[model samples]
Target: MIGLKPPAIDRIALLAAHCDDIAIGAGGSLLTLCSARPGLRVDALVLSGGGTEREEEEHAALTAFCPGADLRLTVLKMPDGRLPANWDEAKAAVEDLRARTDPDLLFAPHPGDAHQDHRGLAKLVPTAFRDHQVLGYEIVKWDGDLGRPSAYQPLTPEVAEAKVALLQQHYPSQRQRPWYDREAFLGLARIRGIECHSRYAEAFHTNKLTLDLAGG
Candidate 1:
C-alpha cells in the first residue's frame, strides 16, 4: 500500500454531538497529529453539554488531546438526543463554526451513526464544509453501529496508551457508563490496527476525497 502524506495540515476542525465523542472516536489520531505538528490550530464544536461540568471536562480533554495546538472549542446547550426537533439550531451552530475557520482536515460523526443527534449533525457537515476533507468518526455503542470504516490512522502503542489514559483522566463524568473502560477502548483500537496492519489504530469513514497524485 502506497501511503500518501497530507500536505501540511496547520488547521483542523472537530465536531461532535456530545462530550467525549471526539475523544472516544479519534483521540489517538489527535495525539499523533498534534504531537507531531506542535502548535497546530484545532477548532472543536460540540452540540450539547454546554455551560455545565461536561463542558469543562470537554475543554480539558480537548486541550489534553491537542497537546500544543491552538484549540478553540464551542459547546452548545442544545438538548441531548433531540437534534431532529432542533434542526435549525444545530444547522446554525455548524454553519457558524464553518464561517470561523478554513481547516485542512475535519473530524465529525458519521452520518450512518445510530444516535439521532450524531447522525443529524453528520448530515449537516457536508452542507457547511463542502470543499474540505471530512473524515467521519465512529462511536461504539449498544446499537452495534460500528460498520467497516474506510480509512485508518495507525497509532503507536505509546500514543494509544496515552489516548486511553487521557480519556480516563479527563472525563470523570462519563465513568459510570458500562462501555467506558480501558479494555473496550484499547480492544477496538487493536482491531482497527489489525485492519490497517499496525499495533493500534483509529478508523474513519470518508464520504469523498480528491486525489492529487500528480503533486506527489
Candidate 2:
C-alpha cells in the first residue's frame, strides 16, 4: 500500500485519460519525491493528449514539475471525450503500462469525477495494478464532482504556490476555463488543510486502505 515508508517504492505510475491529470492530482508530491530522492523513477502515462502542441507543453510542464526524478512520459493517442467508445484500446494501454513497470504506487483520477475520460481511467487502473497501492486524487472542477475526501496530504505554503504557478505558467490553453484559477487550487487546499489541521493540503480517497493502528 502507499504510505510514508520506503520499500522499493522508487517506481511510481501516474496514469490518466488526459494530459493534465497527473499534474492536477499528485504534482506537489511528485515534486517533493523527485527532489528528495535521487534516481527516483516515475512513469507518467496519459491515455490521450498526443500529436498536438498541447503535448509539447505537457512534456515541458511535467519535466519542470518532477525535477530530479527519472521521469518517462507516454501519451496515448486515444480519443478524448470518447473513452467509452474506445474501451479495449484504453484497457490494453493500462495493461501494457502495468506489465512494464509493476509500479509500487499509482496515482489516478477519482472515479467519481464527472468527466467520462477521468472516470474511465479510474476504473481501468485497478484492473491493471491489482497489487499496487492506488490513490485517487481530485481535480477541482465546476462540474460539482468534488466529493468528501478521506485522506490528506499537508502542503507547505511554498509547495502550494509552486503547484499553482506551474499550472498557470505551463497550461495556458486551460486558463480560460472558469475552474482553472489559482483560487480553485488554493481554496481547495485550504479546505482540506482545515480537515487535517495543516496550513494547506491536498485530499484523496481510496476504496481500500491499509492502516497499522496497532503501532499507535
Candidate 3:
C-alpha cells in the first residue's frame, strides 16, 4: 500500500459521543502523534459522562494517551445513547469546540457507525469543521460495523501494546464489558495491520481529502 503523510499537524481535535469512545477508537494514533510532536495541542469534546466517574476516567485516560501534549478535554452530560434526541446540545458543543481551536486534523467516529450516538456525532462533525481533515475512527463492537478503511496509521509493536495497556489500565470501569479485553483490541489491530502490510495499525475512514500531488 502507498503511504501518505499530512504536510503539517501542529494541532488536532477529537470528538466522541461517549467518554471512552476516543480512546477505544484512536488511542494508538494519539500515542503515535503526540509522542512524535511534543506539546501538540489536542482539544477534545465528549457528549456524555460529565461530572461522573466516566468523565474522570476519560480525563485520566486521555492524559495518558496524549502523553506530553497540551490536552484540553470537555465531557458533557448529554444522556448516553440519546445523542439523536439531544441533537441541539451536541451540535452546540461541537460548534463551541470549533470556536476554540483550529486543528489541522480531527479524529471522530465514522458516519456509518452502527451505534446511534457515534453515528450522530460523526454526521455533525462536517457541519462545523468544514475544510479540516477528519479521520473517522472505528470502534469494534458487538454490532459488527467495521468496514474497509482507506487510511491506516501503522503502529510499532511497542506502541500497540502500550495502547492496549493504557486502555486496560486507565478505564477500570470498562473491564466488566465482555468485549473489552486485550485480545479484542490486539486482534482488531492485527487485522488492520494485515490490511495495510504492518504488524499493527489503527485504521480510519475519510469522507474528503484535498491532495497536493505537486508537493508544493
Candidate 4:
C-alpha cells in the first residue's frame, strides 16, 4: 500500500485574521477559479470578526466575490489583534483545520507585513501546514508594507475591476482609511504588472518555490 501521499494542491486554503483579509488578498483569484473550474474548492478562514454586523457583511461580500464557494468560509472567532499574545489557542485553531484538510495550496499574509496580526497569521500558516504549497499575499498597509514583489499574478481587467468593486461596495468600514481608494488598488496592480508584463496584477511573496525550468 502506498504511504500517505502528499495531498493534491487543487484544494486551496485562505487564512486571515480578519473578515476582509481573504477578499482583499485573493478575491480576484478566488472569483476566477471558482467560476472557471468546478473541481477546485476555496476555503476561507478568519480568526476574528468585527461583530455580528461585520460578519453579516463578510458573508455578503464573500458571496458576491466567490459566488460558487459556499460551505467554505469558517470564522474561528479568535482575538484579532492579539493572535501573537494568544499563540497557543491560535495555533490550535489552525492545527485543527490543517488536520482535517490537507489542501494543495494555502494563502496567508506575508510575515514581513506591517500589521502585527497579518504577520502573526502569516507565520502561523507555515507552522500548521508544513509541506503544502503556501503563498504569502501582501496587502497595502499604511505603515509602508509595500515592497518590490518578486512574484506576480496578472489580473484580468474584469478581475481587477471586480476586486476594486467588491472592496468598495462590500466593505464599508475599510473605506474610511485614507489609503483605501482607487489609487491604492490601481497603483499596486500597476506596479506589480510592470514586473510581469501586464497592465494589472496582484503581488505575493513566497518563501519556497520550486521552478520547473523545463516547462519554461
On TM-score, the leading prediction is: 3
**Candidate 4 per-residue lDDT over residues 52-99, each given as its tens digit:** 566777878888876665437777667768888988877887898897
Worst 10 residues of 4 by lDDT: 1-10
RMSD per model, one decimal: 0.8, 2.5, 0.6, 5.3
List the candidate 3 regions with Cα displacement exceeding 4 Å: none
Reference-based lDDT, each prediction: 0.95, 0.83, 0.95, 0.77
Model 2 regions lying over 4 Å from their true place? 1-8, 211-216
Backbone clashes for every candidate come to 0, 0, 0, 1
lDDT of 3: 0.95
- Model 3 root-mean-square deviation: 0.6
Cα RMSD, model 2: 2.5
Ranking by lDDT: 3, 1, 2, 4
lDDT of 1 at 213: 73
For model 2 the TM-score comes to 0.93
Question: Candidate 3, TM-score vs. the true structure?
Answer: 0.99
Residue pairs with clashing backbones, model 3: none
Model 3 per-residue lDDT tens digits across residues 1-216: 887888768999999999899999999999999999998999999999999999999999999999999999999999988988899999999999999999999999999999999999999999999989999999999999999998999999999999999999999999999999999999999999999999999999998889889998
What TM-score quantifies how close candidate 4 is to the native fold?
0.88
